[model samples]
Structures are given as C-alpha cells and as structure tokens.
Target: MHAIHIERHGGPEVMTWSERPDPTPAPGQALVRLGAAGVNFMDVGARSVGAPGWSAPTGLGVEGMGYVTALGDDVEDLSVGDRVAWFYHPGSYAEILAIPATALVRVPDDVPDETAAAIMMQGLTANHFTTETYAVGPGDTAVVHAAAGGVGLLLTQMIKARGGRVIGLVSRAEKAATAEEAGADHVLVSSGAGFEQRVKELTSGEGAHVVYDGGGTATFRSSQLSLRRHGVHAYYGPFMGVPSLPVTDLPNSILLTYPTVQDHVPDREALVTRTAEVFRMVQEGRVVPRIGGRYALSDAARAHRDLESRRTTGKLLLLP
Candidate 1:
C-alpha cells in the first residue's frame, strides 16, 4: 500500500506519496480500502506544522469514507463489504487503513461515497455550531464567515434548514453567488474587518443572533461586533490567525466559545447519532456539498496548493 506521508513538517511539498507495508486489522480494528478522503483546512495545518497527535513521520489525513474489507477480533457489528465512514481516525490518507471499529460508522445507502466522505468533518462541525454552540431558532439571524468554503456552505444550509437567516461573509465577490445558492440570505464580500456594519444593517440594527466565525484574527472582532446583545460568538477559525482577547474586550454581553467538533461527538454513541442526522439531511436535500475539486490520491499535494490559494470554493476530495 502507499500513502501520503511527511517526514518533516513544512509545506505541501513536504508530503510524499510513498510505499508502505500493507496493514492488517488489529484487535478491535477494521481494515478499510479508501473510497474518498475529504480535504480540510485542518489537513493543511497538519501538513504545514504538526498538530497534536500528528507528529512527523505520520500519514496526513483524518476524514474519509471507505469499504470494510476485513475485521479484527471482537469487531462483531461490522461485516466485510460494509460501507463505512469516519471523521477523526488519524492517518486516513492511505489507500488502506486499520481503523478502530468504534471510530467507524456505517454509511447509509442513500448517501454516495464521495458525499459521505465530504460531509463528515465539515458537516458535523456545522451541526455543532448551529445546535450546541447557539441553538439557532426561527427568525434568528447568523453571520457566517467564509460562507463559500466547505464549512461555511454547510453551516449556511444548516442555519437555513432551522429557519434562521444567514448573512454570509466571503473574501471575494465572485464567491457571493455560491454562498447565496447555499441559502445565505445576504452575502458580504469583504477582505477583513469592515463587514460588521453590513451585518448590522441587514439585521435592522439589532445585530445577528449569532456569528459563526471561522475567519481568524483579522475578522474576529468584526464577527463579535456583528452580534446582538447576549448573542453567541462561536469562533472556530484558528488557521488564518489566533487572536488574544482580554475578558474586558467582549462587547454586547455576548458569549464567546471555541466549539470543537470532538466535543460534538465525544464517543461512539454520539458519533452514530450525529452522523445519522447529517446523512438524513443529505438524503432530504437540505444540505448538498459542492465538490469544488477532486484529485488523484498521489496528487494530493496539488490539492493542498489549490486550497491554500483560497481560489476554490466548497469541498475538495481525494480519490484513492
């Protein structure tokens, strides 16, 4: 088997499609042949510098969907040939992987393989933002940063599915229609910090009920300013830049939180439940991922280059 591995962290150039010994299923593990792998900003971060649990000499992917070819001891629930998807199993960039059975969820027949892979990470993060982070209700307004990107598009749709209005923030005007197509009621094309006024204006000067901010430091304060009094500011963006804030700087009596997707699915039970909801939403057509690009598994470095350029919108996929 071959997988993308990095011996030292640097840029996309650091990733190499190298040969490796085929892995056998270990106890409580299931061997999966890769169907499709989702490319996320988190993957970029992992490739650029090592994140926790992602040290050098490590394979470079976390979310993907595949078929179970074999099962290890005590893995009674899953059978060979079953379609499965996982959101957080490390080293998912390979043509095959030995993932713990507990981390894998059966993919519904209604969901396509690539679609299932695309939605797992970004979809669940969107679910966490809309539900637990702020519990978006009918008529509530939300400001979603990077609205044309993967998480942004899904978050916009989920917010709309719950009957809430979305004021999408995009870095480019050309991406506005994409965000609008995903149910953003309003789209603001702003580079950095000046989007709060438009958000306020759209919300009738009352400000938004919540701001789902994945737009790092430059836009952090703007996201907060776009919220109403007592509104929730969910800052999930850490890649662009991480900003330091003093407690006294918080405005509008709003609540600030960094909602991680891991908390949304702390265990196998939560994983099953959350993924089921995301799959049902896809089957119902409430959430449709725009597959912006697909690259061969060996050519993943180019995919990373395209993503880092910020020219592509929506989800990118890797085919093995």
Candidate 2:
C-alpha cells in the first residue's frame, strides 16, 4: 500500500509518499479500501508538532471514506463492501486503512465518495459546536470566524437550518460571497479595521448571541467583543495559532466555552447518530459540503501547501 508519512515534524516538505506494507484488520477493526481522504488542519498540526506523546515518522491523515474489503472478528453488523466514513482515527492518508468498527459511520448509497470524505471531521465538528455547545436557537444570532472555511461553512448552514442567524467573518470578498451562499445572514471582512464594530452594528449594538471562533489569536479578542451580554463563545480551532485570553478581559456576564468534537461527543454510538443526521441533511439538500479541491494521493504535499497558504475554500480531499 502507498501512503503519506512524515519522517519528522516540520512543514509540508516533510511529507513523503512511499510504499508501505498493506494493513490487515485487527480484532474489532475493518480494512477499508479508501476512495477519498479528507485533508484537515489537524493533519498539518500533527506533522508540524508531531504527536502529543509519540516519536517521529507518524502516518498522517485523520479522516476518510471508503468501502470495507475485510472485517475482523466480532464485527458482524457491518458486512463486506459496506460504504463508510470516519475520523478521529489516525493514518488514513493511504490506499487502505485499518479502522475500528466503532469509528465507522455508514455512508448513504447516493452520497459520493468525495462528499462523504469531506464531511466526517468538519461536519461532526460543526454539529457538536452548534447543537451541543451553544445550543443555538431560533431568533439567536451567531458570529462565525473563517466563515467560508470547511467547518465554518457547515456550521453556518447548520445554524441557519436551526433558525439562527449567522454573521460570517472572512478574509476576502470572494469568501464573503461563498458564506452568503451558505446561508450567513451577514458577512464581515476580518482583514479590515473596525471588524468588531461592524459585528456590533450587525447586531444593532446588542452584539451576537453566540460567537463561533476558529481563526484563533488574530480574531480571538474581536470574537469576545462581538458577543452580547451572557452570550456564549465557542472556540473550536486554532488555525491561526493558539489564542491567549485573560480572564479579566472577558465580559463578566458572558459564558465562554472551548469545545472540541471529541469532548462534545465521546460515545461512539452518539457520534454515529449525530453524523447520520448531518449526512441526512446533506442528502436532503438542507446542507451542502463544498469540496473546493481534489488532489491525487501522491500530491498531498501540494494540497498541504495550498491549504496553509489560505488559497482554497471549503474542503480539500485526496483521491486514493
């Protein structure tokens, strides 16, 4: 099997495409013949920082969609040739991956492999953020940073579907248009000065009821200021860098929460159920996964470069 591996943590240059031994399903695991793999910021972080507690040369990729070619013992519910998608497992940037059955979610037959691959990580992250963390409701207002990015677009659409209004923050006018198309009620260009003031104006001086911030340090303070009194702030990612927040700087009455998909949905069954809901939305045309770019598996380095350069929008996938 061929896979992308990072011999040492550094940059996109560290990624190597080479042949490796084919993976066999272990107990409680299934071997998937990957059709597409999702490229995420976490992959870059893992390569740049190495695993939290492991040594170098880690296999990259966190999520993908494929068909089950073989199943381990005790995996009876899912048969051979089951189409599935999954994340939270590692070493997925390959032609074949050995993933635990617990991590797999059955993909709808009508859904394309690319869309299935695109949704797992970003879709689940958006689902947990809006529905679980803030519990955004009808008539509530939300401010989403990086509004045209993968998870941002999905989050904005999900919020809209739940009757919440969203204010999208993007770096470019093109992205603003994309956000608008994805159901963001208001779009703000974060590169300009007075971004926070604009957000405040959008909410008629009251500020948003919730702020979904993923841009990290650069927009952290503005996110705090964009919220109304007693509003919730959900910080889900550090795309720019880890944000530093002082307790004193926060509004005394507001609630601030840093939630991750893993933290919000810890049970495998619950994760699968929520993911099914997301997929249903996609299948029913209520939610759309914007697949911005596709690259061959061997071209993972270029994909990483494009993502880090901020030249792409929505999801990027690798065809295996």
Candidate 3:
C-alpha cells in the first residue's frame, strides 16, 4: 500500500507519497480499500501544528470513502465489499487501511465516492451547526462566511431548508455565484472591509439571528458584527488562524459558540446518528457538496497547497 507520510511536519513538502506494508484488520476492525479521501483543514492542522494523536511518520488524513475488503474477529455489523465512509479514522491518506467497522457510514447508492468522502465531515458539521448550535428557525437571518466553501455551502442550504434567510459572505466575486446558487438569500463580497455593515443593510438594519463563520480570523469580527443583539455567533473552523475575539466585546446576552463535530459526537451512537442525518439530508436533496478539486493519491502535496491558497472553492479530495 502507498500513503502520504509526514516524518517531520512543516510544509506540504513534508508529505511524501511512499510505499507502506498493507495493514491487517485488528479486532472489530475492517481493512478498507480506499476509493477517495477527503482533504480537510484538520489534516492541514495535523501537518502544520503537530496536533495530538499523531506522531511523525504517519498517514495524513482522517476522513474517506472506501470498501470493506476484509473484517477482523467479531465484526458482523458490516460485511466484505460494503461501501462506506467514515470520519476521525486515522491513516486515511492511503491506498488501504484498517478502520473500526462500527465507525463506517453506509454511503447511499446515489452519492458518488468522491461526494461521499467530501461530505462525511463537512456535512456532519453542518448538521450540528444549524440543528443543534442555534436551531435556526423561520424568519431568522444567518450570515455564513466562506459561503462558497465546503461546509458553508452545505450549511447555507440546510439553513434555508429550515426556513431561515441567509446572507452569505464570499471572499471574491467568483464565489458569489456559488453561494447564491446554494440558497443564500443575499450574497456579499466578504473583503473583510465593511462586510458587517453590508450584512446589516441586507437584513434591513436588524442584524442576522445567527452567524456561521468557518474562515476563522479572516471573517471573525465581521461575523460577530453581523449578529443581532442576543444572536448566536457560531465560530466553527480555524482556516486563517484562530481569532482572539474578546467575550467582553460581545453584546449582552449574545450566544457565542464554538462547535466541533468531534466534540459533539458523545459516543458511537451519536456519531452514527449525526452521520446518518447528513447522508439522509443529501438523499433528500437538502444538502449538496461541491467537489472543487480531486488530486491523484501521490499528489497530496499539491492538494494541500491548493487548499491553503483560498482560490479553490468547495470540497477538495484525493483519489486513491
């Protein structure tokens, strides 16, 4: 098997596409033959910041879509050749690897392999953002930063499906079309200059009921400013470095939240339920993930460079 190995994390060059012995399934695990692997910010964080649960000289991804080629002892919930997608499983940037059989989400027949891998983490995060974080309702307005990006596109559609109006913030003019197509009631160029004022104007002077920011520091303050008094500022990811916004600066009684899908999934059952809901939403035509780009298994380095460039839109994947 081949995988992207990072011996000493520093830059994209550290990820070397190299050969490794095929892994054997341990108890309750299944050997998954990789189809597609999702390249996410978390993977970049692992490579850049040396995030926990990883040491040097390991694979570089945690979410992917694959097939069960073999199963270990006592694993009966899933069988061989079953197509599945998973989140938080290590060594995903490989041709084959072992994963807990129970952690796999059965991908629907209609969702393509790339699409399934792309949505597993991003869509699951979106599910919790709207349904749990703030419970966006009818007549509510939301400002979704990075509205053309992976989770933002899905999150925008989900909020709209739940009857909330969206004022989507995009970094460039090129992204405006995608955000609007994703059901953003209003799309504004998120130049980080006067964007909060634009959100207020879009909402007729009453700020948005909820603000969903996945771009981190680049859009943090504007996202906070777009919120109404007592509105929810849902800070999600750290794409442009984490922000140091002061809690004292927020309006009185406002709800400031930082939700991660990993932290929200309390147990195996919760993980299964959240993933199932994301899959169901896709099946119901409520959430659609845009596959911005796909790189060959050996070209993982190029994928990381493109993702950090901020020029690419939607989900990026690696085809194994």
- What are the clashing pairs of model 3? none
Model 3 agreement with the true structure over 1-320: per-residue lDDT tens digits: 89999989788989998989989999999999999999888888888877678777677999999999999998988889889999778789999989988788788788878888989888888888988898989989988888888888999999988999988888889989999999988888865646888888888887889988777676777777787789998887764577775678876367888898877676888888888788888888888889999899899999999988878889999997
Task: Give the lDDT of residue 298 in candidate 2.
Answer: 94
lDDT of 1 by residue, 1-320 (tens): 99999999999999999999999999999999999999999989888877788788889989999999999999999999999999988888899999999999999988999999999999999999999998989999999988999999999999999999999988888999999999999899987898888888888899999998877898999888988999999998776778998988999999999999999999989999999999999999999999999999999999999999888999999998
Ranking by TM-score: 1, 2, 3
Model 3 local distance difference test score: 0.86
Model with the higher lDDT, candidate 1 or 2: 1
Give stretches of model 1 more than 4 Å off: none
**Which of candidates 2 and 3 reaches a greater lDDT?**
2
Model 2, C-alpha of 269: deviation from truth (Å)? 1.6
Q: Whole-model Cα lDDT per candidate?
A: 0.93, 0.86, 0.86
Model 2 misplacement above 4 A? 51-55, 192-194
Writing each residue's lDDT as its tens digit, candidate 2 over 1-320 gives: 99998889888999999899998999899999999999999888887886574257788888999999999988977889999989777888899988999999888889888899999999989988888898889999999888898988999999999999999988887788899999999988875235778888888899889988877676777778888899888876654577666777788378888888887568887877888888999999888999989999999999999998876889999997
Error of 3 at 5 (Å): 0.8
Best by lDDT: 1
After aligning candidate 3 to the native by TM-score, how far in Å is the CA of 246 from where it should be? 4.5
- Model 3 worst lDDT run, 10 consecutive residues: 238-247
Question: Which of 1 and 2 is ahead in TM-score?
Answer: 1
Q: Estimate the TM-score for candidate 1.
A: 0.99
